[model samples]
Structure formats: C-alpha cells, structure tokens
Target: MNVTDPKANLAALIKCPSVTPAEGGALGALTEMLSPLGFKVERSTETDENTPDIENLYARLGGEGPHLMFAGHTDVVPVGDEAAWTHPPFAAEIADGQMYGRGAVDMKGGIACFVAAAARYIEKHGKLPGSLSFLITGDEEADAVNGTIKLLERMAKAGETWDACLVGEPTNPDKLGEMIKIGRRGSISGWITVFGTQGHAAYPHLADNPLRGAVQLANALMEVPFDQGTDEFPPTNLEVTSIDTGNAATNVIPAAAKVVFNIRFNDLWTADSVKQEIITRLDKAARTGNLRGERPPVRYEIAWSIRPSHVFLTRDDKLISSLAGAVESVVGERPKLSTTGGTSDARFIKDYCPVVEFGLVGQTMHMVDERVALADLETLTQIYETFIERWFADART
Candidate 1:
C-alpha cells in the first residue's frame, strides 16, 4: 500500500510467477495492493473447454463523469531455461540498480508505477476528481481468448463504458519517454499446401514433385513488395516461416508440400485483400509446368488463418495532448506517437475506447536477463502521476 516507492512495489510484483493462464497468486497480490486504496475489486474467471481458465480483475474507485481506465496484463511469458539467467527470472533481484525478471520491463513495472501514482495522487488530492478503474487480465502473453476481450463484453452487457483507457505496455524503445504507441499493425498467418502425385524419385517422369511448385509459390509471394512505406506506417511484410514435405527418404516424393507464412501488414490492405492476393499468385504458379497430362502443373489447396486486426490510430486531441503534456512535465520531452510494433492487448482495447501505450523502455523485454532500471521505475511513476492529474483536470471541460 506504500505508493511512494514504485521500485519496491514493482519488486514485489515481479516476484510472482504468473505465467499465461495461471493466476500464480499475482491477481491476489494486486487485489491486496489496490483494496486498501479504496478500490472495489471484482475477480472474474473466464473458462473455455479449449483454453485454460484465466482469472481477471476489475477494480474501480470514485464515481462520476469522465471515467478513465488503466488496462494491462499480469501474465508473463515463460522463463525458458532457468539456468540461462544470471539472476532467477522470478526472483526480482536488484543488481546494479536494475530489477531483473521476466515481467519486470514488459509490464509488471508499469502496473506498479501506475498504482503508486494513484496512491500518491490520493494522498495529495484527497480523492480523484473523476472515476478511475483497472482492467487487468492474465492472458495477454498467450492466446488472449479469455482475457480483456471477454471482460469487455461482460462490461458492455453490464452497461459499463469508459471515456478513455491507457494500456501499460512497455512502449519506449531505448529510454523512458522516447515513444508512445498510438496504433499497431495487423497480423495474419496461413498454411499453403500444394498437392501432387507421389512416386519414386528415381523416375522423375513417373512422379509429380510438389516441392518445385512450393518453391515457385514462395518466390511469387515474396517477389513483389506488399507496399511502399506509407505516411504513418512502414511497408507491409510477408515471410515464409517454414516449408515441409514430410518425406524422410530421398528416393520418394511426398504427396503434398506445405509452406507456412505470416504477414505483418499496414492499413493499405485488409485481410480479405491479402488472402485474395496470395491465392491469385499461387493460382498463377500452379499453372506453370505440365506433368504427364496436358493439364495444370499441380493441384493445390490454400488454407488461410486470417486473424484480422483493424488498424487504429488515436488522434483524440484531449487524450493525446494531455498525456503528452504530462510526459513533458515529468521527463522533459514529449514522446513520439508511433505505430511500429508487434500487436498488443491494445489491439483489443482500442475497440472499446481511445487507448495509448506508455510505460518503461522495452529494449530488454522478452530477452535474456530482462530488467528495468531503478531510476526509470521512479521516473515512470512520476510520469503516470502527472498524466493522471492532467487527464482528470482536462476532463473537467
């Protein structure tokens, strides 16, 4: 409940090994931390027969116009080989003034700073001028099926709405206040299988090899660039992740060849358009070389898993300007508004309210020896406190 020192709060949070779909007592810890601050906490467990049940928390304080929400995940990615780390990944060790842990930088640090900021704000202002709430989930690092998305649905069903939201994802690339995420690129993945006849490799004329067709398809997919750099985003990209024929013997040709690929695209193309383009290119490649008959070179089937994420840009002047002002006030520089990054939970939160990502520098996130600087922990807490005050102050209009 001591909000003065964010580093201490973060140290406590990073000690919890709350990996994906596992509570690991992280939410319980957070509940205890927030409850004493006058927040009414509610826990919801979402279960799917396919995915492990996830426990989430929704806590709020104050009741008035201009409700502001802070959204983040407590779950962390696996620590991989524990022996590879100098300090235990979940030990929350502080060495050279840096806190080392899996979720130390990628998130838990942000949550701690915000909570500390809220506590400090309450101490100074007596009570928040506007409503404040937290939407915390445990599935951000995993499939995200039973996390914020489900919670938002439930909130809607219960007639709850927010004016704005902030996701505590690490957005700074090199240093605190260097960058804030305003949008994110969409992602789509697919598997392409080119079918052919299986036969002895010794007799080339007798067998139809699918590998040749697959190579051609891959070449075609990568030959043309998806787009030139746009004004707001970089060029779209597609990469072949894997290619397999499952043929163990050199003398035998497999019946089918498969290639898996992923595309990180900008707003220029939609999921439907990208899939159509792949199909068009593959169709052209399939007609290239003839086998034994006068028909097409190979028969093929393309299966696409297009999980579309609509590109969102938050240009809300009040939301952007107030947060930017706060960052300037605390860190002495206004952060750049960027859309460059892999997708995040903000992708889902954007649908409900105008959301931006601002937190610690992420250069160490998801890497070996993930850590956060002790100084940064305090500075981030100051930034969040300033933003909270400015956001509520501006909402009065």
Candidate 2:
C-alpha cells in the first residue's frame, strides 16, 4: 500500500482528461486513493444557474484540532494543439526524468504530492494526531462558481470548520522553494461604452466622434497610478484590454465606441472604492475631453463585473513558520514570502480559514508540454510530509 509515491499517483491523475468542468473520473480516482487511508470521502456535485454541474471531493482523515485542509483543483486547462506536444498531453509519459501532461504542474501534481505525503505519514505514525482533509474541485479552470466557494458554503452550512488551509496552485515560478504566496492582489473588470453620431468620414465636422472619448477614458485609467503601493503589495494597475469602434466602412463614422479594462489592485483600495474613484476619473475626463465637440456631452455607460476578489494577507505565524521550516529542511533553501501572482483558489479558501499557497515550479503550467521534474515531485512530497508532522506538533505545543 505505497499510495504515497508521487510518480504513480501523479501519472494516474494526469491521464484523466478532466478539462475545466469535466470530471474525467478524476474525483473517483482520488476517492479510491484517499479512502484506504481511513478518510471518509464525500463526493458533492455543485451547480450554479446556467452553469454546468461540477463534481467535487471532500475527504477527511481525522476529526481533531489544528484542522489543516489541502485545497486544489483536479481540473486542467485545455491542451492547445495536441500535435505540438512532445508527448500526448494525457499520456503521463516520462522522458528524461520528467513527466509530461496537461495538469502535471498547474495542479493535479500538487494534489498527488500532498496525497502521497499524507499516506506516508499515516503509514509511519500508525495514527495521525490531528485532522487532515482534501478539498478537491473540478471547476477551477473555467467558471469557478461551482467549485471551492460553493464547497466552503456547504461545509459551513453543515457546521464544519478548519483552522488553516494550503492551496496547491504551483506557486514557484522557476525553481522549487523559490516562492510561497502569502497574499494576492484584488482583481476587477470594467466595461465602458461611449456614444457618438453616425456621419460620413468626409463630413467629420457633422459627427461626434466617440472614439475620442473612449481614448480619453482609457488614458484616464492607465495614465494615473492608483496608489504608491503598500508594504505587502504593489501599486494598483488598470490595463485597457480592448477598444472597439465596430466600424467596417472607411467612409462612415461609428455610432459608438467601447472599451474594456481590468484592475489588479492592492490592499489600499476596495472594489467599491476603486469603482467610485474610477467613475470619478471617467466623469472628469469625459467632461473635459467632450468639450471639444459642439454637438453635446459624451453620452456613455459603465458597468462592472459582479464577481470580484479582494486582497487578503495571512498573519498566522504558526502556519507560515511551520511550512517555511519544512521547505528549508527538505530543500535546503528559505523561500521568499511573495504576494505577486494573480488570484487562485486561495482567494476563496481565505474566507474560511487562514490560507497560503506553495507548490512546484509553475514554469511549464499551461504551456504546450506541461511537466514536473521527477526529482521535484519527491522533494515536494517530502516537504508536505514534514510540514504535516511539524504543523501538528506546533499546534499541540
């Protein structure tokens, strides 16, 4: 019963085509591995209105203090151009001491390593002192509505609680033990529509050009710094991802212009405050930029994405120090505590418990031939195993 080997466990998970909302038997495979280790596994299917139902796994090995949860998504991103991959994305083929697959690094690999660690711990200790659980979701890559957020909600409704959580989302950028994410910047998107009048290009004076207003609005967002940046986070940045006039004919002035932008903000601002500030900026910019026209003010509409993630920081010295010690002991290097990456499942887990992220180097995640070095797999497994022992000891003390 050496279920604690990453090479076999990860290879099995990568073979599942569990792309986005698809199950591909990944959860079942996880249940099979976890159930043998005295974990009571529950498979839940969650759904949102107009979204596909997603299967999720929640397996717990014990029911005691210092409850530690391991959260990850079994779903993998779509393999873009199968023929371009050196090996089939789902084959889990090992070459040159590396295993190649779609979910090898971005996350199924993390799950496998954690599972291996837990299994090994139980085999050695005869009984795990405190609680250990796995919160595995199948809808992380696409619409996240049916995933961790809902799972946490269900757990809360049932009066379940966790002291802390670790999300396995491939935190390291280039090398193992390089970075550990303690926090992430908040994110929001804005949509703006600028109004104009239709006229011939030859009769430019007769038409109000909305393109000018769109440019001014976009510039208002980009040209100004949102803040000076906080101690744990960088300054906020608003990027204009798209602008469209929708005019096909070279002779006709378009009736409207549209611009879309996203903001990766730090803790200095909330989504609402950022929205208000942006509205103020756009209004001021439009009032000034539209004055050049004789027709009227720049009529426009603005909307925001309904779902927004807020910035969060974990101050749990016990959890941070425990994991850090494990990394140093296993990998021989102290990792950098960073808050530089985009959002992950950690955002949702943070609401329930203090959460941090650490995993394999993510250089190949989502690339053509996503892979994990054979050596890193064993190292990460050792790290997780050591963290489990130290974490329980620290909590008890």
Candidate 3:
C-alpha cells in the first residue's frame, strides 16, 4: 500500500469502525502503514478494575535524542442515527470534495495525515536528525482510564521519553491554519443532592421542598464569577447541567433534589483550589437556607467526578515556532496561539512533555455527518511534513 497518500491512509483507517474501547482493525491498519516505513510498532492492551480494556499503539522510527511524539486517538464517538448520514459512517466515502466518516476529523484524519507526513519526510530526506514516535490510543472518546494515561505510564517505566509532543486533535474552527491550541482550561464536574422531607404540596409548612435549596445552591455557584479572566485563559465558567427531583405527582414534594454541574476553570486556580471554592460557596448558601424559610442548614451531599483535568500552557518557544512556521509556510498565515476548548489527552501528555495541538478544521466533529475535506487532508500533511523538517533542524542547533 502507498502509505504516503493521506486520502488512502485515511480511507483505510475510517473503514475500520473503531468505536471507543474497540480495536476494530484501526490499529492493525496503522501498523501496516507504518511498518513499511521502517517503524518498530508495538500494541499494548490496558486493563483496569472497572474500565473495559483498551488497545494502544506506540511506534518509533529512529532511537536518538530530541525525540518528537505525535499523539492522537483512533477511537470515535458513536454514530448517531446512522440512516441520517448521506454516506455510511464507516465507509470513508468521498462526496463532492470531502470524505464522510465517524472519525474523519476528530480525528482519524489527523492520524492519517501525520503518517503520510512522516512517510513523505522519510522518503524525501532519508532520515531525521533525531526520532519520531506515534502515541495512538483507542479509548479517548470514552472513559480515558485505559488509554493514553496508562500507556504513558507503561512507556515511561520502560525508559521512554519525549522532548516535545503535538496532539493532532482538530483545533481549527472553520479553516486550516487558523488556530493552534497552546493551552487548555481545566475541567471538573460534581453532583449535589439536597435532602428534605416528603409531604403533600398542599400543606405549605408540612414539607421542606429540596428543590428550593437546590435552586439556591445552583444560583450561588453561577451568580459569582470565579475570576475576571487570565492573560492566557478565559474566566472560569460553571454551568448547572441538570436539576432533577424525580417527582411526577403535582401534589407531592420529593424527598431529594439533585443538581449536577461542571466548571471549566482558567490558570488562576488549580483543581484543588477550584474544588475548595465550590465547597465554600455551597456551604455558605446551604447555611442561609433562604428558601427553606428558617429551616436547619440544607442537608446535602457532594460527589465529584473521578478525574479532574488540570490546566496547562506550552511555553516551549522553539517547539511552538517550528509548528507555527510550518503552518505559515503551507497556509500563508501564522496560526493563532489559542487556549480555548475543552480538555483533551494533551492534558495527560503535558505531565510528560511540553505539548501543543494543531490539525484539520473542527466544523463537524461528532456530528451525524462528520467528514473532512480532501484538500484539508493534503494541506495538513504538508504542514506536518514541514513541521517535522523545521523541528528537527531547530533541535540540531
């Protein structure tokens, strides 16, 4: 197979239907592509107590210093309403100028392009000044417990290290070379359940409606701003995603109400600090019992999500310049260094090395008809190829 062609590489991958936690032949297809290019490929399956096993791939070409790691995932979100798509979700069918599929842009397309880029670089330049590695995971779209985090730990224990990393998550909003994610906001989620007495709604003072306390607590979290905003990040924002009482009858007040919330915080606070702040706010509001009408402190219990992604920024000047310069060389403009967007596996990669992200436009990620333009695939391949050249040249000096 001609692994240097981005479209062919992507089509082979997209046909695999590798939904979260499933191998689905995606890694096998990747192995076939990389093996011919002289990469020593290895696949490892990660297992945990509660999480399903996940298969991850790590392949390297060359074993020298200043190694570059390209990180991404092959797992895709489920294809919703399969009948609604004009092209089959796993068919990799090209209509007009775009290829339609589940992981086309978020992002089996990125993986394909990077593979093609590395292939093209090797074909033209013989060998890199140092090394290049691919860290691909199959559990990114779902519970990440058995994916990159575990793979990174295992690899590090085997004495593997990287100088810098580029995560190929789709970063462009509308077009290629428009933005590169240099940092990401931290994220945390929690559920608050407020307790009360169950009684008939007709008796005004007979029952304490937990809904009132839930509303007050939810309001307290949203009413106050976490921070004005940071120089490198936006202000911390929290949203009350759900409020449930599970009460159906109009005449009855429920015994408990649950309020679920998630917050995306900026650099001004760490996960611990933000968590503390949330507890403080909830405690203060619970004490008032304003809507409880002089009742005892609102009875409530809080449970946080198991994993809290911490905020980070990449300050590696040479690494940043090499990628930005490549984008400019291909697309005729320097990409914006952005910190917007939800968390990605880059959050985990950051603990190991300085990491940044750039890839295809993200206009249709996870949508019913998720797809990628053929042109964007070719262009991204060129940009990745150029980035490889620039980074290795910079590292040599």
Candidate 4:
C-alpha cells in the first residue's frame, strides 16, 4: 500500500478546523483512515467541570512486547484574521508545492505523515515487527486540563505502557533536520504583592509608598543570576512580565503593588529551591529598605501558579540512536539533540516514559499563512517509516 498518499491525508486533516477543546471531526477522519489498516482504534472523550469535553484517540496495530508509541495532538491554534491569508486557512491548498493551512506545519502534518508511514510499513512487512500505537489528544493548545494528562491516566488504568515514545511536535527551527528536542527547560510563574500604607504624594512623611518596596524587590530578584546551567540545559532565567499598582492618580500613593514574573529554569534548580531563594532575597531587601513611621516595613506575599514543569532529559540510548539514525539516513545529516525550547505536551509525557520530539521544519508554525513544503512532508513520511522499521527491528522482544 502506498499509505494513501500523505499529502492527501494531510489535506483532509487540515480541512477540519479542530481548534483547542474542539474535535471538529478530525479524530473521526483519523479513525476512518486507520481502521482499514487493521488498527484497533479507540476514541475516548474526557469531561471536566471546568473544561470542555475533549475527544482523544488511541489506536494500535500489533499487540506484543516492545511497544512504540507516536504521540501528538490534532488541535490547531486559532487562525487570526482569516481574510489576511492569501488562501483560506482551512483550504489546505497546495500552491507552488506548499500546503497552506493553520496546522500544516505545527502538527496536523506530522500526524498525517505518521499514519501514512505506518500504512506503508504494514504494507511492506505484512505486519509490524513490534507493537505500534498512537496517543492523540485534542487539548494541547489550551488550558490542557482535559487532554493528554487525562488520556494517560486512562491508559494507565487500563494497564497500557510503552517502551519508548516520540512526540511529533514541530521541533525544527530553520531546516528540516537541524534539531531534535531531547529535553526542555523547566517553567514557573510567580506573582508577588507588597503591602504598604496609602497617603497623598505631597505628604512624603505620611505615604508608605508600596511602589518603592516593589521596585526594590524587583531589583533584588533581577540582580542575581538563577544558575550557570548544566551540560544538558542553558542557564536559568527570570523576567518580570508585568507590574501593577492599580493607582490612577498622580497625587495618591497606592496601598499595594504586585509584580508578575516567570522563570525558565534548568536542571540546576527545583521550584521549591527557586522560591526559597526569591523569598530570602526579598526578605533581605525588606530589612534594608526605609519607610515612613505610619506604615510598617515592606511586607509581601508570594503566590505561584500551576506546579512548575521539572526539567527533563531523555538519555535512553536505544530511542535516541535509532531515531537519530533514521533522520541521518533520510536527511543526510545527523540532527542535533537539543534542549533549547519552551515547553510542549512532552513535559507531561516525560513522566511516563522517555520521549523525544522530531518533525517537519517549523519556521512558519503559528504564523500568518502557516504552511509546509509538499516535498518536506514526503521526506518526513519516509523518515518516520524508516525510524519505525529500525526501532522495532532492534527491539529485544
């Protein structure tokens, strides 16, 4: 089987506007495509009181040991200003050898290529050498409250596990095979609030001036470096994203000040350690700062958002070597194993099993007229097919 042509499959997927939290029939289309290949496809919908019900799919073809899973999401980010595009965002039009659509590069393209690759592998070998499965979700781009995390729980409850997993997120920055994400930097967000007395600006002796305390606190946090980084990750960084006092008048000092900051940390620190460091620095600053008699010294409260993502590295030799070999075979160059990106669903999947991300060049993902080269899609399909073959052939079971 020719795998039903990856380009055609991608075009069909692009036509479905399955934005975050909405299925848009994309999973249905996938199920239809996989069912004919002797795959046992299961569609699961997870519901939460706070989030919309999301539809996910897990499909498998072989059932023995050494299971290899391909993980991805079908949901595309919102298309901003549809009229601004040269072609419709959902048209999936192929012009000048490029497929233009919202998710052509970000993700849908990867799913299409994998499906075609799997079909071709089965056609050539009559059956996969080992188990093959796909874990797809529809809530990766939004709050993520009801997406892959829920699906993984369901899978675990059902006694499912994998030897290794590949996340088909768009990882390449410039070229098709320049980078493969082997790890990701950890992320943490914090909100700091400082309390003081409010008074008229004219009466300097009466006003406590919370802004002054906030400024001092911000300086203390920014003055020192978080860490020098490790061999696998870059140095940690903290940046104040916003500062708010809610004061509108020029003459009145605000009673409180708030600063919002985020840190993209490395392997050198954990969320608790980072928080403790911040508190220590702020306390030191507060002790040294001066304030009017009517107002007490600077007092602050710090709150953290969701739990921070712990830095993770994938060192599994077999998974890395096989995927890298396949990439080199198809792209003519060994891809760089990098950990220099933001975050992805892999942050959640890493807890379950070792995971690596590789896919098409992502130079235009989440940008206007987002698209992928038709030739690149074909090449990626070949790479996935090759990787699947080699990975299973090398399996012990």
Best by TM-score: 3
Give the lDDT of residue 95 in candidate 4: 95
lDDT of 3 at 313: 93
- Over the stretch 1-397, how does candidate 3's per-residue lDDT look in tens digits? 8988999999999999899878999999999999989999999999999889999999999998789999999999999999999999999999999999999999999999999999999999997789999999999999799999999999999889999999999999989999999999999999999998999999958888999999999999999898998889999999999999999999999999999999999999999999999999999999995775778888899999999999999999989999999999999998999999999999999999999999999999999999999999999999999999999989878
Per-residue lDDT of 1-397 in model 2, one digit per residue for the tens?
Answer: 3678988899889989999889998898888899999999999999789999999999887887779999999998899999999999999999999999999998989999999999999988988888999999988898789999999999889778998888988999889997899999999998899998889889988887788888888998899898999999988988999999878898898999999999999999988899999999988887775545544556889988889989889999989999999999998999999999788988899888999999999999899999999999999999999999988998888
Better of 1 and 2 by TM-score: 2
* Residue runs of model 3 more than 4 Å from their true location after superposition: none
From the highest lDDT down, the ranking of the candidates is 3, 2, 4, 1
RMSD of each predicted structure = 1.9, 1.3, 0.9, 2.2
Global lDDT of each candidate: 0.86, 0.90, 0.95, 0.88
Error of 3 at 217 (Å): 0.2
User: Residue by residue across 145-188, what tens digits does model 1's lDDT show?
Assistant: 89999998888788778989889999998889988888888888
Candidate with maximal lDDT: 3
Off by over 4 Å in 2: 290-295
After aligning candidate 2 to the native by TM-score, how far in Å is the CA of 6 from where it should be?
Answer: 0.5
- Residue 274 miss distance in model 4 (angstroms): 2.1
Q: In candidate 4, what are the lDDT values of residues 331-382, reduced to their tens digit?
A: 8999999999888889888988889999989888988899999999999999
For model 1, the run of ten residues with the poorest summed lDDT: 289-298
Provide the TM-score for each candidate, comma-separated.
0.95, 0.97, 0.99, 0.94
Q: Indicate the residue-level lDDT of 278 in model 3.
A: 98
Candidate 1 residue pairs in backbone clash: none
Off-target runs (Cα >4 Å) in candidate 4 are 1-3, 248-251, 289-296
